[model samples]
Target: NFILFKTISSCLFFFFFFRSYGGKILVFPFDGSHWVNMEVLLQALHSRGHNITVVRNSKSWYIKENSTYYNIITVPVERGIDQEFITNTTSGIMEFERGALPLTSFLHLTVTIFHIMIEVHKIFIDFVLAMLNDPDFLKMLKYSNFDLVLTDPSWGGGAIFAKYLNLPLVYNVRWILAKEAHFSLAPSPVSHIPITGTGYTDKMTFLQRVKNMMFYLLAQIHYYLMITQTYQQLCEKTLGPNIDFNELSLSADLWLMRVDFVFEYPRPTMPNFVYMGGFQCTPAKPLPQHLEDFVQSSGEHGVILMSMGTFVSALPADMTNEIAAAFAKLPQKVIWRHKGDRPANLGNNTLLVDWMPQNDLLGHPKMKLFVAHGGTNGLQEALYHGIPVVGIPLFFDQYDNLMRLKERGGAQILTLSTVDKENNFLKAVEEVLNEPSYRMNMQRLSRLHRDQPMKPLDNALFWMEFVMRHKGAAHLRTESYRMPWYSYYSVDVGLFLFGVFLLVVTTVFILMRCLYRTVCKPKVKQE
Candidate 1:
């Protein structure tokens, strides 16, 4: 009886201990694909008894008005990045990729992308104004007394809101305001660290490095013109003229980066930047009955899974026909997530579903290869499942994500322009499937990724709780962002030392010349 009483007491103690540590978190999330990952984090937090309130636009693409895990504070807006905008932008990029003139296509793509970015940021700014201008909403937020603001830093509204609330800020981050989070928070040397969209790796030739530097410069220009100036105006109008949006972006107490070295190339990172790559990945659950039957039917030949992620619902008709025709040539059964008109060339071995269980399908024993658009979440899931990939990157960071895996010998990349021509899709798929090295290398990566001391999700949770408990992690944050460019690089000190060296050399030379004239002139006169 005494022993039973002790066990009960211990159980109660632990239960209360966890219950007391539950925090109130205010989440500002980016919609679309980013929300998919953020929702994973939110669910975990919800299971841990944390109170999560998500701030979303009324017309958000993926985020709904209702959720079991979190409360929603929807900001009504006339404009938001909806499906139509994404579809149009993606279609334009596709057209540009297929254009005959390379230089002209490149220029058009750049201009179109920049214009889209400007429009998106303008919408984000409008959302921020709507929120700030609402007195009742502001009062409700202020009184909530949240422990920390957890946000994806892709958009600046969250960071701005956190500052306005005077709450501790934490980031569930991969991308920041205008670039990758690492470039904003770490020492990103262009010589080795390739900028996004460059299609180069850490090991670069001289010309590649030159191109990398140029891209880095272009990113900086984009940040200054599109992000800094635009957001700075909002900051001044809302918070104060003294507030710096760039510095605010870097001021997160903890950065839960969505990548680890197993997937990302080795590079310098900040103390507060914690990598939790593949945190959203979990062991596969049993597939749906029909899906299970389909997998079982594949027999010894195995299966290939294809998804273009959340953004690209379907490809152009001709391209889809090319892909479908190529799939017809393969022995393996194909399960494709396609949301468009049925392709006439689609084979008997292929099944078209509006959606498939991507992670579960990847983890299945019959799964042989993945045909993906190279989204980070999808690639990470593939890595977790030890599956080789044939990457057909469409836009944004997709190509870069694939390039990382290709560099590691676990994946093959095919450009959109080349994928439809000369049986490239079939060739690339066949190469990955037949190549022993592709699967072996990917399995090796899987081992390395799984060999972590702690699971990525647990690590992320611990740091988040650490921030909540401590109020903030200011000590781990660097003041380098506050430094002027000359001071940060020590250029001023180098110039000062150079000037001192010149002065000393000139003084010594002058003394030696005088000594020679004074001593030698008298001797010559005596002679």
Candidate 2:
């Protein structure tokens, strides 16, 4: 009986482990909202008996074994950022709280120029020091007793922490982390400043793309200098002095980005680069009964949901009115997330609110379309609910996100630059609402987005476990910084030095021969 039981248990173990699988999973996301899919990922992995842990900035969240299920755990991280930036408190560069005035335009311009120079100088020095003296550097390693580090690629800290700990890094691309990485991760194809989208599939013709490229290059320069410096400072505040950021691993073991190749702008592709486009972009739960009824009541004209995203504000009333006027004309009820400016005589069909549970609102069946500011999260939410969209891009990657959706034939993009005009705003909104093609296209994209072979949450779990099973996938994502651009291009400084040596040697030989002939010829003849 004992021999039979041992053989049976051995066979069961073989069934589980024979395929070469299982290991600890460590996830480090930028923030809590970013962790929404991560939470689901953990649950799925737990069912497979994988050990899981998460490091959120300084906080640690983990999962433990339960009788029937795995238990979730959270470890509080208590370390401070030893950072001092040019704009430490205010908009001023070099540490002064100055968005101030000289009382005149000319003086203000002059002051601003001087202020910018000061800011540049301060930023360089501050960033250098902050990177070297990061207080959280040692703490990250201590907390992350990890076999691998999974990071939101945009979150520089994750990459930095992974490098310091020498853990295998996997970049979960959400926003545009890499411009040319086959899977386009950003929002807009237009290449607007700070605004993301487009990915590799920017829809403009060659001339348009060239134009986009020009702006893209300029933006990249600005990002490398300004935004990346801030991120670098954050990395430094954690990575410390000895670790060379210039030589850190950038490519994750696998880049599990929230992208679907079927829906994205076409570009290059990588095996390790997993496109989890509509990753758990799912709604949290159902909508309220009242909100559901509001949509149900709209018979012929369905309701349109408008939101400008959480971070951006609709400050300029000009753009807001264009939206209001469009809503005013539409027969459909507009459930606008109207922040500030409570127009005394808003259309009775429009409902104004400061805070809302947006995911629930999108999930509602009666919702017809979404008028968005082209945020990635917002776009995903709309797509998740299979709602059509008219994207009015304000700034950041919102512009690019809108462009990609436009390219996919699922949504329409109206530049905010033109939104102020009454006809333009009205026409664009009309096109999105009346067009059957857009709705059909969106539904098609939704199906393809959903018909992914595996759920994003599941795919994410597979990759997490993959790292544990196969050891680290570090060699896969080659950090570009580790090799200088020139070095990567094989423009060896050593080769240049060798060329210089050869030139000098030839010159010296020519001169020596000339001198030897001149000095020795007459002397030998005389002798």
Candidate 3:
């Protein structure tokens, strides 16, 4: 067995050895979540003998000044996720498809609204900004051309940028969202699919199941209309009237889903979708002696880490107070990331700070659990380290993500709706800390998640070269690629008519034979 295993491993290594991942690459990671991951990828690619460039707008996450980056351009920000009026509007879901519109999910509703409105508002803002950037963009284009435009799926504006620049785009999703499954424009493989009527066991009611389907259709319809209207104007303003909107939407291609398949629920997906996990890792910098010592002393008793990330940091004080009290009660040491002075009457066991090295904390041997806001990046980091989670979902895809983690028995969720309640926060932390299942499940998943023979970054870089080598071959397409659900499954009005025809024919034949024997004079002979 040992000899056989060695032989197989050696053969596989040689097979992959011939593939070229070492090539010139440029990545445009517009969001903060994309920053570290892209950096990790560039470094990986660099080690593989590839040249890489990372460009950004002023809003881009902090990038080191003089690095191996072939070229780094910091463009001016015409717009950003933050806007004056946007910050005030406390909703994310906009009504279009009732199913797509979240009903029971307050968190999903809020976060969806943020994504929709910001991009909708930014369409015009980015266009005008791009025009202002035409001179600079054109000048940069002259110096170098990118083989692949790696982008965060959230940056719908980046899609436009890719289109304008005439570059092939590959997407990296920071969040685990169902939208990518249905949205044809995403260019990645559809990761999640409906379980019911489609054939799976779910406890949701028939009406509820239908509503879920409706939600998907609604979301697609909403984006379709929005993108159409927005793109039409963009064409008129930028490309003039000759180009058809439909063609542009279809022609927009290339996708790389950054999610690790092992971590998400079982679902149908396509080949265009690839994983780029572990894209977020910080460069080696020595930690402060105090920080290192803090990590060392916090032994088997376990330490809990908490953070809500930046955008939603402006949380209600009541929620903040509830969290503090909960932290004070835990047997474990708690390090909570927040802003402003520590509230009076804090406990020695609880440490409050304006910032914390979340990834680093998760990596510590003493780290017991992570209390996160359920943002995709935080969730990914938690999963990467195999640390159990206590989710306090705020908005957007947070609820769904937390739900997934909860269902998997990998985490505990404490809704923001009840966070201000002392009992609620305290109970949640206690449940997470005491529950051995969450940790066991987390470890199980972490093993499976990391079981990959090759890491996601290496896999993506390899496949990317495969794309260039194959000259954009359809080999990357999955079995799902060949069939649209309706056509492939033969579930349609046409199939219904065919079944009706067969039924009618069988019924008529039986009736005609009966009548012939009873009334057509052949009955006497038969008797």
Q: Can you write out model 1's per-residue Cα lDDT over 367-482, one digit (the tens) per residue? A: 99999999999999999999999999987789999999999999999988899999999999999999899999999999999999999999999899888999999999999988
lDDT tens digits, residue span 323-371, model 3: 7776777677878787645665567777777777778878777788898
In terms of lDDT, the poorest run of 10 residues in model 1 is 99-108
Task: Mark the 10 consecutive residues where model 2 has the least summed lDDT.
Answer: 89-98
Q: Considering TM-score, where higher is better, how would the candidates rank from best to worst?
A: 1, 3, 2
Model 2, stretches more than 4 Å misplaced? 1-28, 31-144, 175-206, 223-249, 283-285, 478-482, 487-527
The TM-score between candidate 1 and the true structure equals 0.96
> Model 3 Cα displacement at 319 (Å)?
1.3
- Give the lDDT of residue 376 in candidate 3: 70
RMSD over all Cα atoms, model 2:
8.9
Q: What's the distance in Å from true for residue 99, model 1?
A: 1.6
- Better candidate by lDDT, 2 or 3: 3
Give per-residue lDDT, candidate 3, residue 200. Answer: 18
Taken over the whole model, the C-alpha lDDT of each candidate is 0.92, 0.60, 0.61
